[model samples]
Target chain A: AQSVTQLDSHVSVSEGTPVLLRCNYSSSYSPSLFWYVQHPNKGLQLLLKYTSAATLVKGINGFEAEFKKSETSFHLTKPSAHMSDAAEYFCVVMLTGTASKLTFGTGTRLQVTL
Target chain B: EAGVAQSPRYKIIEKRQSVAFWCNPISGHATLYWYQQILGQGPKLLIQFQNNGVVDDSQLPKDRFSAERLKGVDSTLKIQPAKLEDSAVYLCASSLSPEADTQYFGPGTRLTVL
Candidate 1:
């Protein structure tokens, strides 16, 4: 079974500081990884996705994630945190040939403050 | 392009009652999916449809939960005899095809079972 484990249940960062959300994966084979963000009372938005093409994936809102195969990790990062960046982040995995069935990790809530 | 659309942004009902949520996928999207997101948890796939045909529903609780995309465009998810555990946000998403990696999401329908 393909699954992702979010290392932190909550992360707090001051405005303009760097932010990191850790995630580890357990998959039998190479898998598609994704980062999604959800604000309160809003729908989930795809932050980024990592297929086999590239290890470093850039996403909207100045966010990016690096897929480290050897480490079995895909961690989301941002150079500067903003108040708008406060939201719940999820790490998701999609196994090949599954017709887009996604397995999501328990989310990590981000809190950005001045 | 318009994103996925869902009706009745919020619903409240008593346990053992029934409720339904509706979704309209993006224009020309051939794949639709329903996901249940409990508070503090990432969304879980409940079902997937490929052009009006059920592609995957392994995780759905068929005894109490049902869903259908009758015309391959709009979809509906029904929960009969709702349980308190069933209270969660129901999210609808769609992609251009079953193999598409990016899925657009709609503002979810929040259901509360008393």
Candidate 2:
């Protein structure tokens, strides 16, 4: 009943430049959106979340995402990309009524260059 | 606080072979979840447990997979007869509150079947 879509399979950016990873979702109820990052051979880490209370959510490592109800999107954006930011990013969606059952998008691999 | 921990970071097995992976979530985390991430894909929730009780397992490959969280702390996932298509990284995540749904993930067990 709920689904997320990562529009870009890959996003390449240079260090110190802005990074953008697009994501969209469809849910019958009000949706909670999240962004998670995964380094090679590592687990996914929470980047940011939009709990419906705030449209613009700030997360660790200077990452942020804006939840747009009109567009049905919650795209992740960072002012600058660090070399350490090279990793795979995921878009997740869930319904508050469901109690932590999350739906994940395919993924977006970010390649940060020097 | 320590993050989620998983054992047997990597495992290789032949078709129809059985295998199991273990996970220890963060201390005091009441909600635990199991997910499968195929290469190039995001983590997919296979099961969710809240204090020793199952909340969801709709996406789980019930025919080939089984899991338990008896003590409501540590958990395990087993594949009775893995197929080549079963290769993936098994991720374990935990959250403080089931309703909040901000999950922290483990490094995961990568299983490769030939």
Candidate 3:
């Protein structure tokens, strides 16, 4: 079984400040991880993914995440938060088999304050 | 390339009413998935399809939900006798293949069961 846990249900940050959203996972297989952002009334957009290539993965909109195996974590980070960055972010784990299935975390709602 | 598309962006119905949602994935994609996202929560996979065949429906509420993919292209999900708890956004995502890590999502159909 594979599952993801978002440590923070909500995170508030001032514009231009650093942003961090913590996530952890449990999986039996090697596991493929992903970060997705959802703007209100919009579909989910893939931010980045870790497929065993790099420990630190860079995504669009200046977002990035580091996969830490020892910590069982994949925390998303942005150098600076922008008003446009305010959205709900989800951590997902992909389970491999005959078909791949994704398990999502509860999500972290990032609020960028002016 | 066009992204995934879904019909009936929003729907409201009383308890026990039946509702269905349609999804058209990206062209040439062979894997499709259905997910349910409750307000303030993450998306949960309801079913997955490889081509027109079902790969997984382990998390689907079989008693109330059913889904089908025709010609390995468009797909439909139906809910019979929906409950108030069924109020959520139904997301449809597709990947190039089962092994692909990235899944492009549609805007989703929000269903509210009063």
Candidate 4:
């Protein structure tokens, strides 16, 4: 079984300040984790992924995430939040092997206030 | 390259009405997925197809939901007698292959039931 949990239901960050969205996961086998951002009325865009490669992964639009095995977490981070960064973010876990199913977290709504 | 495409960006219907959504994956992508995202919740997998073959439909409400991926390129999902609870956003995503973890998503179709 694979599952993900986003620690915060909503996060408020000021523009030009740092941003952090915490996520945790549980998987039976080697897991693949992903962070996706969805702007209002827009598609879910890939922010970053952790597939047992680098613990720290950089993504588009100045986003990044760190995979901490001992913590069982993959939290998204950005040095500075922009007004355009306000959106809903999801943490997903993919089950390995034949099932290849993805389990999504409840999501965290980030509100960037200027 | 062009991203995944979906039609009928918005739909409004009454209870018991039937509806369908269409999706066109990115060129050369062999894995397709349909996800349902309820308001305030993360996207949930509805069905998955690999080269026109059904890979997973466990989370799909098979009694009313049906999907098909013909020619391993285009796909469609249908819901007969949709209930009020079925109102949500339907998201389409595609990956390069069955084992690929990162996925590109479409803008999604928002369905409103009355």
Poorly placed runs, candidate 1 (over 4 Å): none
lDDT, model 1:
0.94
Using DockQ as the yardstick, the better of models 1 and 3 is: 3
Which runs in model 4 stand beyond 4 Å of their true positions? none
* lDDT of every predicted structure (CA atoms): 0.94, 0.92, 0.95, 0.92
lDDT of 3 by residue, A1-114 (tens): 799999999999999999999999999878899999999999999999999999999999999999999999999999999999999999999986668888899999999999
Candidate 1, residues B4-59, lDDT tens digits: the string is: 99998999999999999999999999999999999888899999999999999999
lDDT of 1 by residue, A1-114 (tens): 889999999999999999999999999988999999999888889999999988999999999999999999999999999999999999999885759778899999999999
Which prediction has the highest DockQ against the true structure? 3
| Separate clash counts for every candidate | 0, 0, 0, 0
Please give, for residues B65-101, the per-residue lDDT of candidate 2 as tens digits.
9999999999999998999999999999999878866
TM-score of 3: 0.97
Docking class of 3: high
Interface DockQ of candidate 1: 0.77
Candidate 3: which stretches are off by over 4 Å? none
Interface RMSD of each: 1.2, 1.3, 1.0, 1.1
Model 2 has fnat of: 0.84
The alpha-carbon deviation from the true structure for residue A93 of candidate 4, after best TM-score superposition, in angstroms, is: 1.0
TM-score of each: 0.98, 0.96, 0.97, 0.97
DockQ result, candidate 4: 0.79
Candidate 3 structure quality by residue, lDDT tens digits, B73-110: 99999999999999999999999999887899999999
